[model samples]
Target: MISYVKGPLVDIFEDTVIIEAGYIGLEIHVPLSVLDRLPGIGMETILYTYFQVREDGMCLYGFLNRQDLRMFKQLISVSGIGPKGALGVLSAMTPDDLRVAIISGDAKAISRAPGIGVKTAQRVILDLKDKIDMADVLPAQFAAAEGPEISAGGVAKEAIEALVALGYSQTEANRAVGKVEVSDDMTSEDVLKASLKHLAFL
Candidate 1:
């Protein structure tokens, strides 16, 4: 398997990039989200790649981060989702947001992706909910601070859910909310607003 590609970014098309490595230009299909984060042309970049082989031919799909690559793998593992469909999902939302959507059973969020219907979104949630872990999806800073308050599903959990609904990554939501000073009198909305203020400076 071709695990990764590292080279100068020679060209970037609508949904693909050409990386020149060892005198060979490798074409890699990437999600729109990856393209948004790519460096300028001629800069060296590394892409975690998945090589797909089928009866017709072969292709390469690349991601900017290992987490995105892992999410792509998980999405494709679903019965009705193919590589293209999985890429569409990644293009629509960050991997962290996708994980939150799955965990929260937010089919509408998943269905926002092109070519993904409500039924498919539900299927994605149903299939991947138990498979994903908040610790695995959240950044180390957030995961290290996880306590009974967040785990036990209270105002913190509700705040995180609201942030996720607003398109923030789970890591971003978690870290931001963790930084906020919570009180017994605070509502989920208060926590969310405080978290947003914290995230704005980050």
Candidate 2:
């Protein structure tokens, strides 16, 4: 039932973060996609968490947003996908992109993850496709927002496609674009450059 952890980010590893909360340090496993979103060490941040337990042990996986947490939960629920496997999927593609790939039967796209093979990707789609709606890929608030919100999403989408054409996975491109602080004046190409700089860090 521990929904989240909030504190200054004390340290960050390749796929984990340490937060100092209430005088104790909490080590949390996080996806690679969350790296760009993390604040500088000593800066406060919050991570939505899922607590997993098994006969062997217990673990905590965290995400920058609840949407990712929800997606992680959905992924782990699929047969043959464990918590680490689900995290790998999200690390490879955004939840929206994964949904699109699954719904479109694009197993090749999903199989790009580190350990997931085509068969596991197919299983994930088979088990979860019926649970997703096409419309769910878009954030609900932006679905009806007519102007700025729509424009931002379009810019990001265009940038993501451009990055994909460059051989970056959907997750990396999406996260890179997200890390860019694009003003209304910035074009998709401009965002693309900013995203490239972030990708260089990765």
Candidate 3:
């Protein structure tokens, strides 16, 4: 299996990218989110990839990070969701936001995806709820130090909400908050401040 592709980005289409690796231009379908994050053409890039083979043909799906690739694999494992559907879901929500929606049983959020309906969203939640854990989805900094203090009182959640209210996207909010270190006594305001500081550097 081709685990990843690393080379100069030669082309960027609506939902695909072409990477020139070893003198070959490898075309890869990517989520809209990944497409948006790609560097300029001819710049070196790397994408973790999933190669799918079917009776009719072969396809390659790429993601900006392993978290996204892992989430895509899990999403496609559901009964009705295919590669296209999974990509649509990722395009609509970042992996961290999707994990939160699933854990919180927010079907409406999942249904916001282009091709997903409420029923499909609920199915995705029901099927993957137990499979996903916050620790697994969080960045290493958050996951490793997630003590009861940090996990309690919904400080992280509130911080993310505050960031969103400040005009940040849900994905951006979640990512920023995930990088913070919190204690039991810290209020949502404190977390938000820290997250905002992190966002400033980004």
| Best model per lDDT | 1
Q: In candidate 3, residue 45 scores what lDDT?
A: 98
Q: After superposition, how far is residue 197 of candidate 3 from its true place, in Å?
A: 27
Model 1 TM-score, all chains together: 0.74
Query: How much lDDT does each candidate structure score?
Result: 0.83, 0.79, 0.82
Residue ranges of candidate 1 with Cα displaced over 4 Å: 147-202
Model 3 Cα lDDT, one tens digit per residue, 70-156: 899999999899998999999898887787677656788899999899999999989997787555544444445434455534878
Which candidate number maximizes TM-score?
A: 1
Clashing pairs in 3: none
Ranking by TM-score: 1, 3, 2
Alpha-carbon deviation at 152 in model 2, angstroms: 25
Candidate order by lDDT, highest to lowest? 1, 3, 2
In model 1, where is the ten-residue run with the lowest total lDDT? 144-153
- Give me the overall lDDT of model 1: 0.83
How many steric clashes between backbone atoms does each model show?
0, 0, 0
TM-score of 3: 0.73
